[model samples]
Target: MEASPTLKEQVSILEEQVGTYETVKSSLIEIEEESDVTEEDFSGITFYSDASVKLYDIDSAYINQLLGTYAIVRMSEKN
Candidate 1:
């Protein structure tokens, strides 16, 4: 997936399958915004998985972010 399609390529393909270029481009923009993921600093993890773990990835990322934020608050309280 690293070599995924560029935005232009995706738009062109989608337009061909769906409708007009402008309409497809606008729809893609809206969909992208609706499905946007928050960026976070997640700890490196390694384990064997049958792909179910993939579903937990976003949940765990947010948990990691919350834990980091809590740690920062605790440190500030100590100071």
Candidate 2:
């Protein structure tokens, strides 16, 4: 049978995967923010900032989490 990867090897592979995921997530977020994301871009209804601003990728849980974190940062700054 084939041998499994050593702990070190597994960790290295995981780290690389994490790095790739981070890069893709960052790009997706940037695209969402720069361009207006429509319903076609996401499966759910898009988000809006007040009445004039629009949030991106409303259907993505990751995007929602990022927005929540961003709000927390801004709120902290105000205080």
Candidate 3:
């Protein structure tokens, strides 16, 4: 039988994954900024779906708040 990873090993794996995610997120933000996309342009972006419920059709203010929270958390991880 294969041995499961220890607690420390699992933590190390998770940390690596987080680091990779942060790097990708940072790169995406940099690209968007360099592309001269305005905040309104970014926020107005939407996804189209044939389903009964459309996510983008919901309250945009809440979506912006969530995005702001995610940016803050990502920034905090740098320290």
Candidate 3: deviation at residue 55, Å? 6.4
Off by over 4 Å in 2: 1-59
Model 1 agreement with the true structure over 1-79: per-residue lDDT tens digits: 3644687798778778775766768877743355467877566766667866554346888989999999999999999
Regions more than 4 Å wrong, model 3: 1-56
Clashing pairs in 2: none
Candidate 3 local lDDT, residue 31: 39
Error in Å for residue 57 of model 1: 9.5
Error of 3 at 5 (Å): 87
Model 2, span 25-79: residue lDDT tens: 8888734356575456455778776979776656688888999999999999999
What TM-score do all the candidates reach, one by one?
Answer: 0.27, 0.26, 0.29
lDDT of 3: 0.80
RMSD of each: 20.6, 19.6, 24.3
**In model 1, which residue pairs have backbone atoms overlapping below 3 Å?**
none
Ranking by lDDT: 2, 3, 1
**Candidate scoring better on TM-score of 1 and 2:** 1
User: Candidate 1: where is the Cα deviation over 4 Å?
Assistant: 1-58
Worst 10 residues of 3 by lDDT: 30-39
Clashing pairs counted in every model: 0, 0, 0
> Cα lDDT for residue 61, model 2?
86
Angstrom error of the Cα, residue 51, model 1: value is: 26
- How would you order the candidates by TM-score, starting with the best? 3, 1, 2
